[model samples]
Structure formats: C-alpha cells, structure tokens
Target: MSGSLRHGSGPRSLSEIARSGGPTGSGSFVYDEATLRSLISKWVALADHYDGSMRRINLGAVEPPGLDFASEALSKSANTSGTAYLKYLEQNYRYCVEQAQLLQDTLDDYLGVEHQNVTELNKTDQPTGSQSGI
Candidate 1:
C-alpha cells in the first residue's frame, strides 16, 4: 500500500468498539480480528507441519545384529546400542512434540478467548431495544 496506516477486516460490529473511533479508541487492545486469525493459521500450520515431520522419522526401526557373527558379545553389544538409540529417539520425539503442541495450544486458546470476548462485548454493548414504546 502507501505510507499510511491500514486496518484489517476487524470485528463485524464496529459501533460498539469504536466508542471513540479516534486515536486510542475503546481500550488498550484495539482488537484486530484479521491479525489474530492470521496468527492462528500460522500456528496451526506449524503444528501440522511439525506433526508430519516428527512422525516420519522412523527412528524405532533398529537394524538387527549380524546373524552370521553368532557371538554372545556381539549380540549383547547390539542389544545395548539398540535400546539406547531407541530410548533417545523416543524421548527427543516426545519432548519436541510437547513443546510444539504447547505453543500451538496457547495460540489456539488465545484466538478462541479473544473472539469470544469481542463477541460478548459486542452483544452487551448493543442497544437492547427501544424502551420508548414501554
């Protein structure tokens, strides 16, 4: 665009929020609905991307020991290495997913909460009806 301030699609009901409609209107939070949606989209996509990537790593498939070797020491060594690698992969996978999920969940929750708060605020601020007839 140009060197001017641009606003997003914003809340459907603007009258309730634009009490001032000037610099520093309503409250601290200007409430940009579009920006919130964009952030949520990114967060969800990241979560999905991570989900796809992390599971694709087939770390659980360990190679069997050399059958031709036929030595107890070799078998024991293979078992130990296999267990260690498996455990490492499992722990790291869990940890990475947990962190990604935490971020995704937090963003999702904020989006829900902000949307709900705006909707409720709009409902409450709206003119109930004309009391003139009563």
Candidate 2:
C-alpha cells in the first residue's frame, strides 16, 4: 500500500494520503472519506456532551429560602454562583447550537437535500392506496 500513494507524488483527493511524518524518512498520510466522516461524527458527539453537561449543572435544584434572615444569608452566594453557572451554560448552549447547525448543513450538503421539500401532498385526482387498481 505504501508504494501505491505517497506525498508530493501527484494530485490526490481530499480523502487521500498526502504525507507521513515517520522516522523511516518515508512519511504517511490519510485523506480518506472514512476519516473525514469519523472526525465530523466525533465533533458532533463532543458538542452534544458539552451541552448535556451544561444543562445538568444549570438545572440542579436547591431548596427555596425561608425567613428574611436565612434568605439574606444565602441569597448573596446563590446569586453569585447562579449567575456564573448560568452564563457558562448559556455560552455552552450557544456553542452547541452552532455546532449542530453546522453538522446539519454538512449532512444536507452531503445528501443533496438542503433545499428539497419534506412534506406530504394531497391530490384530488389521485386514488387512495386501497382504491388503486393494483
């Protein structure tokens, strides 16, 4: 296989071995479709994990404050911590949304369905499944 493809040998596809930086003086590289798909899938999974973690942290439940004195005592800390957590969660959520959109776009491009309609249509002239001559 090494004799077949090598870097700087000639033009190759995006998913082709271009170079290999090994100690044998002959480096190896991979530009294959499987590698690209795996990379994209990993990125999507990472984004999902980050989003899930953020949600779990932000949605943690704590008991409500009681009397005025007790409320005041905990309010300051809760407010500060909650604010920080909320901000972090918001940032992660936005990042996740962006990643998801990007992934969707990639899939659409791959499947050639970016602008295709995905709805059912009713035709008065057409017979129903049971009414068909078949």
Backbone clashes in candidate 2 total 6
Clashing pairs in 1: none
* Residues 34-81, model 1: lDDT tens digits: 554444344434444444555665543445456565655566676777
Task: Give the per-residue lDDT digits (tens) of candidate 2, residues 1-134.
Answer: 66685656643422122232112345645434454344544544555556567767743344447767777667666767877787776687567445445444444444446522111111222235432110
**Model 1 lowest lDDT segment of ten:** 114-123
Clashing pairs in 2: 15-31, 15-32, 16-31, 19-28, 20-27, 20-28
Q: How close is candidate 2 to the true structure, as a TM-score?
A: 0.40
What's model 2's lDDT at 82?
79
Count of steric clashes across candidates, in order: 0, 6
Instruction: List residue ranges in candidate 1 displaced over 4 A.
Output: 1-70, 113-134
| TM-score (C-alpha) between model 1 and the true structure | 0.36
